[model samples]
Target: MSALLVAVLLVPALGAAVIALFPRGRDHAARVTGTIFAAVTLIPIAVLPFARDDGWTTYSATPTALRPWTEFDVSWVPALRLDFHLGVDGVSYPLVALTGLLTVLCCAYTIGKVPSGGQGRTLVALLLVLEAGILGTFLALDLILFFLFFEVVLLPMYAVIIGWGGDDRRRAARKFVLYTLFGSVLLLLGVITVAVNAGTGDLAQLTGGTGLSRSTQLAAFALFAVAFAVKAPLWPLHTWLPDAHTQAPTVGSVILAGVLLKMGTYGLIRIGVGVAPLGAEWAAPLLGILAVAAILAGSLICLRQTELKRLIAYSSVGHMGFVLLGIATLTATGLQAALLGNVAHGLITGLLFFLAGAIKDRAHTGELADLGGLRESAPRLAGLLGFAAIASLGLPGLAGFWGEAFAVVAAVERGGGLWLTLAVLAAIGGALTAAYFLRLLRKVTHGPTGSASVPAGIGGAEWFAWSPLAALTLAVGLAPTLVLAATSAPVRALTEALR
Candidate 1:
């Protein structure tokens, strides 16, 4: 099992290296190799549950104190107290699986729609590197290892956005690098502070707040919060996201929204809260307020957005707000909601970006004013878009519903007047979410087909890329227990540790 886990992390890196070795202009070879490697990466994740002693059902059982499954630890830097530690528990397993699933889908999309100015070999190699980075972040159990993996994603994504993106790609890429690098620096400082104070950088060893003073925990948590908030792009710090999303190629947008953003929220749970429980409690109120503010602000911004990709990007802000709100509650239900919301957003939003890309491909523009009555000319494409939009709007019986609804429910359960207020605001944000998406549907999918030439209905490669997400959305929506069960026990253990 340990070897399999190692393979999971190494496969993408190896693929990236192999793809780099391919000569330029071997576009077909690059795409095929990338897709095969991406798909192969899923094998270990799929087998992980069964490999454990308690099997797949163990995730639903009670979780113990801070122990991880399939741990692989080895000495890396003795002087700095760093070790190469990697593992996944129930909390991380679902996310790791989600990363693998989305990477494969994105690679599939790349096969048919390689972006202009993106040499196929370079693009595929970058995607594989990005995949490895995201997967490693989820699996890493040492602070240094986690940071290394987290930083690994930066350059590749910057290259993807600037190399293959739209008119303002360079500017957007620069903004992205600046904001994230600032966050990364803070993240590094916080990690080093925790390691020096705790005498080790192993997360498994520091699971119970590292025995640090309240003051140190507070400072570290603040640094981590700001750093993650930048990546999570929570409110005031979120200016770079819309530009990056709008300018990025389709696969880039899918991976960005699907997996990259989750890194921040996941860190909040796994590192910020996990390592600094006192700090999390101290900051919960402020976090809640900012989360609600993001919810309202993002939705309101979406209502006015003229570009399809930009609107979807803003919608991510609101959706992530729900995840943050859930995290702020510091309850088992809230944590579970956060996990569910994370995966749901990955699936639903990934699909939305794919649909948005399709529309843009056919219409050569993302402006809502320029697109209308898509259902008239591209019924299948419009139908899929409608489904994804409805799911994103938190309609009942879809993946998006449980996460937002339970987040509000969790907040309501928190019971203080302030929490109740935030809950009400979050609910209102949900309504606003519905409003903007509905308005989007009305403006783009209905009325008369606009001047842009509609391409043939969703293509084979697109259907292959999209079907998994669409099916998962419906499956998880109808059976919330699928994900909720996986996360509940770990969340219980985490909340218990905090208490």
Candidate 2:
């Protein structure tokens, strides 16, 4: 099991090396080899859970909330007390799986279609590198190691955005890097505060806030929340996401919305709520307010957007708002909902970006007004687009429904003036989500064919890249326990810390 953990982290890096070091002109072969490497990663991920030598086990953890079914810990810097410690349990495994799945799909998509600004091989290499960073973050159990892994993703993603993105890619990439860098600074400070005060950098030791004082927990969680909020792009801090998503290439947008954003919500749950329970309780109301604000603001803004990709970007802000709202509730059900929301967003939004990118590529535009009557010329493409939009709008018995419905339920369960009000408003936000999506379907697929070209066919690569996500959306929706089954114990453990 430990060996499998090592494989998940290193395989993608090895894939990137294979692509980048390949002969300069062998672009097609490089892409093929890179994709095979990416595909190989899923094998370890799929097998690791089943191969757990023992049931979930805990180190000498406080409140006994930190458990890893498989773990690897070694001294990397004896002087700083930082170890090359990594682990996977119910809490992080689904996210790790999501990252692995999405990267392979994106790499596969790149094999057949390369956005103009960069060779497909280069983009594939970056994707592999990005996968390593995301995997490391999910797997890391040490604070400093987690931060290092977190920062590893920034540069490769910036390159992807600038090299392969749309017409204003430069400015969008700049904003993406700058905003996230600022967030990183605060994140570093938060991490250092926790480690120095706790006299250790291990997350497991600190999950119950044993060594930190109340005031320290308050200050540390503030820094941590804001840092992650920027990455989560929560509300006002979310300005970077739309521009980044709107200008990024299709695969770039897919990866960005799919798994990159999950890092923030995951951090908030694991580090913020885990390390500083009192602070989470202290700030739950304010966090809930901001989350609801993001929900309403994002949905209303989407209703006014004129571009397909940009509207989808803003919609992420709204979708993630529900995830944050769930975390703010700090209940087992709420946290579970957040986890479900994270994976669902990765699948549903990942597919939406793929479909949107296909539309843009065929028509050479994402402007809503220029993309009318898609169903007239391309019924299949339009049908896929419609399905994705419906899922995004949280149709019942779909992947999107459970997370959101449970989030509102959790909020109401919290039982306060503030929480009840939040519940009502969040339900309203759900209605608005439906409205904008229906409006999007009407404008893009229902009207008379616009002047822009609409391609009627989806190639094998697109289907190969898209089919799994579409199928999984319904699969997870129909059998949500596929996600929640592993999550029950870890979530209950974490929530117990809060109590």
lDDT of 2 by residue, 27-116 (tens): 999999888988999999999788775645543334645878888899999988889999898889999999999998998898788999
RMSD of each: 1.8, 1.2
Could you tell me how far off, in angstroms, the CA of residue 268 lies in candidate 1 after the best superposition? 0.2
lDDT, residue 458, model 1: 70
> How does each model score on TM-score?
0.97, 0.98
Error of 2 at 269 (Å): 0.3
TM-score of 1: 0.97
- Please identify model 1 stretches exceeding 4 Å from their true place: 53-64
Estimate the overall C-alpha local distance difference test score of candidate 1. Answer: 0.90
lDDT tens readout by residue for model 1, 1-499: 7677798889999999998888877878888899999999999889986666334233333332466667777888777667888888888988999999999988888888788986877888899999999999999999889999999999999999999999999999999999999999999999999988988777766665856889988999999999999998798799999999999999999999999999999999999988888899999999999999999999999999999999999999999999999999998889999999999999999999999998998899999988888878888888999999999999999999999999999999989999999999999999999999999999888956777767766777899999999999999999999887767666877787777
